[model samples]
Target: MAVKGHGMEVKDHGMEVKGHGMEVKGHDMEVKGHGLEEKGHGLEEKGHGMAVKGHGMAVKGHGMEVKGHGMEVKGHGMEVKGHDMEVKGHGLEAKGHGMAVNGHDMEVKGHGMEVKGNGMAVKGHDMEVKGHGMEVNGHGMEVKGHDMEVKGHDMVVKGHGMAIQCHGMEVKGHGMEIKGHGMKVKGHDMEVKGHDMKVKGHGMKVKGHDMELKGQWYGGKRSWYGGTMSWYGGKRSRYGGIVFLNW
Candidate 1:
């Protein structure tokens, strides 16, 4: 039996540690560890329930469990969970159930996926994609997919009922119904509505009516109602018979 502390070093028979290093061989296994240097934190346990913590976390055999607050790992068995994820792979096995991803930059391997995008690379299983700049490869696609690399973005993806207005647009479809403004759509079932258009800063404000032009966008001297206007050289003002053109 032997014990040592404070920048510890221990050697008996089945256990050996140098500085803050650790080793537990077999027979009535016991270990307590801490490290900052001296092999810069190393851990080793031959068998039976093992526990490891921080700065290069390592665990071997006997129903392994690992938790990391920051990098470095070596494992014979695996289970992982991440937030603000970054990876280095070894024997990777993945399963995502009812997957929903919002605001995406994707590289996916599929099962059941629901995606909302920004620069995409997808592999399909049960795929549903909502758009902005896309590159897709298909499997069992239930696609509401769009890619012409949208600039000045305004997007709407609806599987049932929808209403839309724009600045820069990208839309993907399922069962789409849109009340318009310079309409562009991908595909499914479509409907669009637009009447009289004017846009400079673009305005639509109506509450209890005083100058009713209820669509969307308002600021400084009224110019909104209905939808559809892309700007350049603006003039056509009388509140609700809107038309302004540029290019």
Candidate 2:
């Protein structure tokens, strides 16, 4: 562990610095290795925990934890089994509400976390986190929340959804969603499924790349780099190609 100005940086080999609690400025902090376990920086004050095991690792803090690879908390109290998970704040006891996972890689959990649906599962890139606004994922990653942002050559974003999975593609807020092909966008109750792709929300913005008309359906009308926009159900859409935008 290399001690920087204040924030203790942990590079490579995480096991070496296990259990060494450092101070993040004033916020007590502690980090563990890949397959190790460590208590929170504030312990009971926050009760954050991190438990990891063979490809299945988790970082728990502020009531959030990331349990890896099919872990079973075989206790007489809270019996919850999970793999690659990050759960935090929001009074934990009340789970099973809206759980959103990114990629094939992670989960987030914690307090003040707004869960949607009685049984909602979001697929991300091997990253997960819950409560108090938490996220876990990297590279070609996708995050679903009230506000998400991504910038780069390859990127796709929807209403509160930020997805980056390609090259030369950059997408901004809800006003736009770019999927290669000169900014291929999908709007209307935005939902990215198998074949059909929908991008819907209050606002959107996209740029970068250009190509043939693919698919699009929205409520606005505009032309960026020769892209067209359509409208329906009193909503507006400014698309450049074919998109699946249906209620």
User: Which candidate ranks first by lDDT, i.e. highest?
Assistant: 2
Whose TM-score is greatest here? 2
Residue 179 in model 2: lDDT: 40
lDDT of 1: 0.22
- What's each prediction's TM-score? 0.15, 0.20
Q: What is the lDDT of residue 196 in candidate 2?
A: 26
Q: lDDT per residue, candidate 2, 162-194, as tens digits?
A: 344443222343323324322223342233322
Backbone clashes (count) for model 1: 5
lDDT of 1 by residue, 1-247 (tens): 1112211111221122232222233221112222111112323332221222322122222111122221112232122233221111212222221111212111111111111221111121111223311111121111233322211223333433122334322344422222333222233222222321121122211122111122222222332212343121124432223553211
Determine which window of 10 residues in candidate 1 has minimal summed lDDT.
105-114
Q: How much is the lDDT of residue 141 in candidate 2?
A: 17
Local accuracy by lDDT, each model: 0.22, 0.24
After superposition on all C-alphas, the RMSD of every candidate to the true structure, in Å, is 25.3, 18.8
